[model samples]
Target: MPGVADGQGLGPVLTVPNLISFTRLLGVPLFLYLFLATDATGWAIAVLAVGGLSDWVDGFAARRLKQVSRLGELLDPLADRLYILATLIALTVKDVVPWWFTIALLGREAVMVLCLVVLRILGHGPPPVHYVGKTATAILLMGFPMMLLARFSEAARPWALPSGWALLWWGIVLYWVAAVLYFIQAGIHVRAGRAAAAGAS
Candidate 1:
């Protein structure tokens, strides 16, 4: 918050927070290799935990150490998205979760991409991250590992699947709600930009 002035963007890309973001981005491929190629669920879950911890760590480092950067802002979310995509693919391939669930999540991302493309063509910035969206992401991150844990042992499955399913479903609902807010925000951005253009004209 100290260094982050507005959603417009921030300073140089060379910073600790950006470094952390870079490290997080590196984990995605490694996670996929462990989960999909080697079938190493335990190791994959550990890698995921690191990814989630890094998500928090990088933000804290950015604010507390005043190392926030425009690159970090962009890359942090990108890393999270890739992690989500990788997790879905790995789990689905392992038969831990259904393919349709992955489709639903990816479909939301596809819609967002289309919205962003439209916004860019019209000369408007994409909407800033909303708290609800962040919360949904965090909740889903927590649930995903638990979901894998469900597959770890039959004894754990009874409680783990239910807990994970509960969080996962709730997170999906929250994610869609955030999508609605984003669309509304996109419209607002467009209208504001048009109003500013008309005033200038």
Candidate 2:
């Protein structure tokens, strides 16, 4: 079918959204290098800005252009996670964020992964992207670059550092809340799956 894929989401593989996602995925490593290796502030900011902009662009294109796909849905979150991972790694190496913070963030993601595996075993699909989760991601993404600027540029320290730290912590708290919501979502799906199976039998 031209319009469906394995009874999942959209069908196309080469969608503008998917391509943008792949590009963002690739940009993760490049962003890491620029931030951690070269410390090229201008280029790093450019890449981060473009990547952030592309995030919005891809989603809009997916809906307006009708190019959404299962691959895209998967890639989009994966890219967001990679970006978060990359930011965490680079900042953690730089001692920009505390170890506990990293652990907390990664821990939530790890639990989500486990929950997803359980859902799959129960023949359910991935959790829907919650608005809370998206807001958390956006806050963190925006905060990271500001934190970098705060670390690297003395001129921007007074404002950027405070704002960045504020946003970052807010994002972290809300992210955990989103994680809790996802767990509830998983539980609902699990019960539904079990009920469906029992009915069928």
Candidate 3:
């Protein structure tokens, strides 16, 4: 979906897009249960597929239906993060991906959290999601399922393993790049805010 201008009034909450986002969020626990408790790799993959598809669908529905909301904005990214976290945990537990891989991705998220906190304390909201961040997220989402397939499906291993790693590495690099960009933007905002305060004082 195209980016709507900031401060465009957040539309209604009970919308098609929000419903789709909520459904995607609901799949997270089911995915975790399937992958970890039951070892249902195939079913887990299916759930992931649905979650990914719904991710796009929600954004499209928001734009097409003119139903974008603050809640939907919050829910959409929250669902994405939860799914990524859930997948990382499951993969790490299965030893499909190295612990360092998880740590690196998680570290970027930690930096992002710090940026958000600093900005919030300075009386600013988070910066808009960068395109690089969105691209990195989409790549990681694609890569995770391919990795699961590579581990479980002998036939897919040849293609999936190499491609999955490539995507994962690329995603990680871009994810940090986006984080740095966000951090820089946050610094600028903080300085401006403080300057305004000092001038007033």
TM-scores, each model vs. reference: 0.90, 0.90, 0.88
Per-residue accuracy of model 1 over 1-201 as CA lDDT, tens digit each: 333344455666667787788898899899888887886878988898788766677778888887767777788788888888888877888888898888999898999899999999998877887878877877778788889889987888999999989988988889889999999999999999899999999
Q: List candidate 1 stretches off by more than 4 Å.
A: 1-10
lDDT tens string, model 2, 104-137? 9999999888988888887889778887997898
Cα RMSD (Å) between model 2 and the true structure? 2.6
lDDT: worst 10-residue window of model 2: 1-10
Which pairs clash inside model 1? none
Score each candidate by Cα lDDT.
0.83, 0.83, 0.84
* C-alpha lDDT (0 to 100) for residue 85 of candidate 1: 82
lDDT of 2: 0.83
Question: How well is each residue in 103-184 modelled by candidate 3, as lDDT tens digits?
Answer: 9999988988887887777689877677788778878888888899999999999999999999899989998998898888
lDDT of 3: 0.84
